[model samples]
Target: MQHIVTLLIAIVIFGMIIGIHEFGHFIVAKLHKIQVNQFAIGMGPRILHFQKGETEYSLRLFPIGGFCSMEGEDESSDNPNAFEKKAIWRRMTVVLAGAIMNIILGFLLIAVLLCTSQKVPSTVIAQFAQTTDATTGETITAAESERSGLQVGDKIIAIDGSHIFSTTDLIYKLQTTDAKSFSVTVKRDGEKITIDPVTFHNDNTEGLLDFAVQGKSKNPVTVLSYAAKDTVATAKLIWMSLIELVSGKYSLQDLSGPVGTVSVIEQAASTGENVLERVQSVLNLTIFITVNVGVFNLLPIPGLDGSRFVFLLIEAVRRKPIPKEREAMVHFIGMAALFLLMILVTVQDVSRFFQ
Candidate 1:
């Protein structure tokens, strides 16, 4: 029963994300007077569909993907209202709408999560971990961070030159970096201070974080401020991960497909000791996933909206359009390659289940 509930929740959340993304394109196209052929919530064969005023709305079988299919999106057409006939600026707006919607969805979700929390976490160091010395049985400050110059009440501003907006940024910087030490920057005594080569370690734990941060009482302003910062932090994390993947710091095994994502959602749903905690856990994951989707879709990969926008930019510069057939062929090839990669990743995800 729990498994079933988790699955249902995952499906609903995924549907909402995909729906909003497609709706962005659909609404923008409509506003620009472009003809939309279909607005779909999923891919593959249609499970349910209806037509209204020249547009077909569909719920398809595969929840892994969705589309807002504009008329003449992939081919030339004589219709004045076709997507290809749109002004370059209008077309670019339509192309970017999906990613913008995904990002907005992420920000909204983050706000929702913050509203239910007791306090907002800040990047200021509150206290360092303490442990008893074995020989003397006396309490001693054990946090390597503290001994390395991080102090209580100091607000972390950056690590290794990357600005820290929230605790999320602090954690990402600490966990993802391979360096044994870091140049930490903090705001203390109304001035900025840089601590060079600060090393964080623990005797008993393998984790690097050795200090706790203070939390601020939540107010409307703080909630909004923190939510926006966290959203940007999540998006930056996604972008950094993608760059690392391209640089060969990560491999195919590190990538997650729809199945793996659902599995992760299930785990998040089952986390925490209470219902509220579980919901917060799931919401946090959803925020990251939505932001990640937004950032990934904006990458200039063929068959994606970003690539289409690039082509539009070229058309604007040249004062002419690329041949429709050639563009369509390029997208087709890119789509095929993407599908193959998805299949491989899905297989890996399924194999993990058995293992």
Candidate 2:
């Protein structure tokens, strides 16, 4: 029963995200006087559909993804309002709208979470923990912070010159960094101070940092500021993760598809100390996934919005668009490659469950 409920929830959430994405393109195309032949909420055979004048709205059988099919999107047309006949800038806007909407929705959701939740961590140091050595099991006494020139009430401004707006920013950089020593900048006595050569005793432990961060209060200014910072932090984390993947720091096995994402959502929604905690966990997951989706769509890979923009740039530079047939063929091949990749990742995700 729980599994069924989780699946239902996943479908609803995924449907909404994908529907909003398609709506962005559909609405933008309409604004530009382009003909949208169909606006679909999912892929595969249509379960339900209705034609309202020029556009057909559909609810398809699969919950995987959706699309907005514009007239002359992939071919030449004589109609003035056809996508290919429109101004190049207008077409670019229509193509770019989907990812922009996803990013907007992600930030809006994060704002909601910030206003309602009290779990956000701040940059001010609250206390320090006495960490134990992983190998020796020896408890290190307090004063690591004191000895390292860190003090309570100090506001962490940056780590290794990267601005630290919140604890989320701090943790993301720390976890991904391979440096042995780093510099810390803090605000103390209304003056900026730098502590260099700060070394973390990373004796094969889960966490290297020895300090506990203060939690922010649910105030208007605090919520708004932290919300913006958190959103940027999440986006940066997504960008860094992609870079790491391309650099061979991560493998295909580390990648997750829709199945893996759904499983994560299920786990997050199901595991919490209380009702509010569970809701907050789900909200956090939503923020992460939505932001991730938005950023991924902006990558300059064939069959993506960024790739379309790249072609437009080429058109601008060459004073002529690529041949429609050739462009369509490239996108078709890209789509096939993406389809195969998704299948492989989904299979890996399912196998993890059995293991």
RMSD of 2: 3.6
lDDT of each: 0.89, 0.84
Candidate with best lDDT: 1
Clashing residue pairs, backbone N/CA/C < 3 A, model 1:
none
Model 2 clash pairs? none
Candidate 1 clashes: the total is 0
Worst 10 residues of 1 by lDDT: 201-210
How large is the C-alpha RMSD of every model relative to the true structure?
A: 1.6, 3.6
TM-score of 1: 0.95
lDDT by residue (tens digit), candidate 1, 1-355: 8778878888988998899899999999999999999899988999999999999999999788899988888877899999988888999999999999999999888888988988888888898888999999998888888888889999999999999988889899989888999999999999999999899886458579888888889888988899889989999988998999999999999998988988998999989999999999999998888888888888878888888888898899999999988888888888898999999999999999889
Question: Judged by lDDT against the true structure, how good is candidate 2?
Answer: 0.84
Query: What TM-score, computed on C-alpha atoms, does each candidate reach?
Result: 0.95, 0.90
